[model samples]
Target: MEQVAVIGAGSWGTALAMVLANNQHNVNVWSHREDQVNEINHHHTNSKYLPDVKLPSNLVANADIQEAVENAKAILLVVPTKAIREVCRKLRPFINTNQTLIHASKGIEPETHKRISEMIEDELGEGVHDQLVVLSGPSHAEEVALKQPTTVTVSSYHLKSAEIAQDLFMNEHFRVYTNEDVVGVEIGGALKNIIALGAGISDGLGYGDNAKAALITRGLAEIARLGTQLNANPLTFAGLTGVGDLIVTCTSQHSRNWRAGNMLGRGYVLQDVLDQMGMVVEGVRTTKAAYQLSQKLNIPMPITEGLYELLFDEKDPKHVVDDLMNRGKTKELEDLSSFL
Candidate 1:
């Protein structure tokens, strides 16, 4: 059995740790909070994150960063996007080039506009990029922790590295697939959160399924536009990380982004909604980064712009929806050319 370290004690990280332990890997979960570490070690449950889920007995928790990565064969970086750089810097001192680094967190860095893999490379040096892999799809942490059947995709520039990651995470209950389009996978995973927020807002506004179905469909188009502009494979968007991830995140109550957007449509301010949610709504930050990226790349993303206005400028949600409804006509396949 290989020793694997899962950085972060959040739901996703914990659920993934469970998967690793289930595979008979010696999984060490690192949490910043001492109480959480104790709870996982003694109680075998992370009440703050996965309350009802029982963690595997072999799974251990640590408060020390060095001990977490020490002698580990693979490191799963599952922290939030905002914390990715800081965590990478701290983790760099312990990580070696031999170990595989797989990141499941999704978001484009706001100012640098770097993808998570790029951010890891920037912080840890380019030598780590070849070993970097991304795992993403429609699977939710809640469902995965319950051992529900879930599927995800792992992508990297190196097919061999991607395959190694595929072997590490795949199990009977959890199925894994490999792809070479790192850009497309990351872009699809990150941007889908923005659409999830819109989905929640649509439902919150009581606009019914028609409005939401439109938002989801058009949302995929703009996502493809910007992703293709970045040289991501357009066909990747048609796979699990693309349409599959979008469908689950935008429609499920388990989505934090959707819940946050729902509150916005229910007339709550951004600050209040964030305060109540007490977790990082990646879409809120991703929306800003994606909006700026679209402007910089000259990509037309009306839905992103609308959400940006509603989120940052305090534009009324109803008015934003109205504007989206009345936008100028265009061909449905306008963005499809980018793929060709």
Candidate 2:
């Protein structure tokens, strides 16, 4: 069994740890909270983050950051995008040059407008291997922890990391695919959360499946537009991490991003919605970063732009929806622009 460390014992982190542990990896789940560590070891229940999912007995929890990083061949850094730097800095002290780091958190860093990989590159420096892999797709932590059938993608600038991650997470119930489109995979994973929030708002506003289906379809176009300009393979946007993730996050009740968006759709203020969710709503902050990135990249991302207006710019969601719908007509294509 390969030794793997999963830092940050949030739902996704814990779920991923479960994936590795089930795959027979000796996983050490690091948590800053002592109570969570105790709960994982003693009761096998992380009731707050993972709800009813019982952690495997083989998966142990550790409260020390150094221990988590030191005893690892591969590390899964599951902290939020904002806290990633701090966690990596903590890890830097104990990390060996040989470790393969897999970053599973999805969200773009604000202000700097960097994706998680960029943040890792900035914070970890050249001392770390480009063997950094990102895992993302339609898998929800809630279902994943329950060992549900899920599919996700692993991508790295270095293909080896993706292969290793593929082996670590793939199981009878969980399928893992490898991709070389790091930019497309990361952007699709991050950007879909924003669209999911928009989808949530549509649902919250009492819009039916027809409207949401329209939003989902149109949202993919905007994502494609930005992904294309960013030099990401447009076809990657049609794959699991792109369109698959968008559908899950935007349509599913288990999606925290979608749940947060639902609250916003029901007229809850941003702060209040965040407070109520008591969890990371990645889409809210991602909307801002993506909106800014679109402006800088000179690409139109009306969904992200509209979500930004709803969250911060005091624009009416209905009006934004109307604006999106009233735009000029275009040919229906599955973003096969490159092939065309």
lDDT of model number 2: 0.86
Task: Tell me how far candidate 2 lies from the true structure as C-alpha RMSD in angstroms.
Answer: 1.6
TM-score of 1: 0.99
lDDT of 2 by residue, 149-201 (tens): 99999999888878988988899989999999988999999999988888888
Pairs of residues at least 3 apart in sequence or in different chains that clash in candidate 2: none
Assess the local accuracy of residue 44 in candidate 2 as a C-alpha lDDT between 0 and 100: 89
Worst 10 residues of 2 by lDDT: 331-340
**In order, what lDDT does every prediction score?**
0.94, 0.86
Off by over 4 Å in 2: 329-340
Evaluated at residue 30, the lDDT of candidate 2 is 93
Q: For model 1, which pairs clash?
A: none
Q: Could you give candidate 1's per-residue lDDT for residues 1-340 as a string of tens digits?
A: 8999999999999999999999999999999999999999999999877888889998999999999999999999999999999999899889998999999998999978889999999999989878999999999999999999999999998888898888888999999999999999999999999999999999999899999999999999989999988989999999999999999999999999999999999999999999999888999999999999999988899999999999999999999999998988887776567556
- After superposing candidate 1, which stretches have Cα over 4 Å from the reference? none
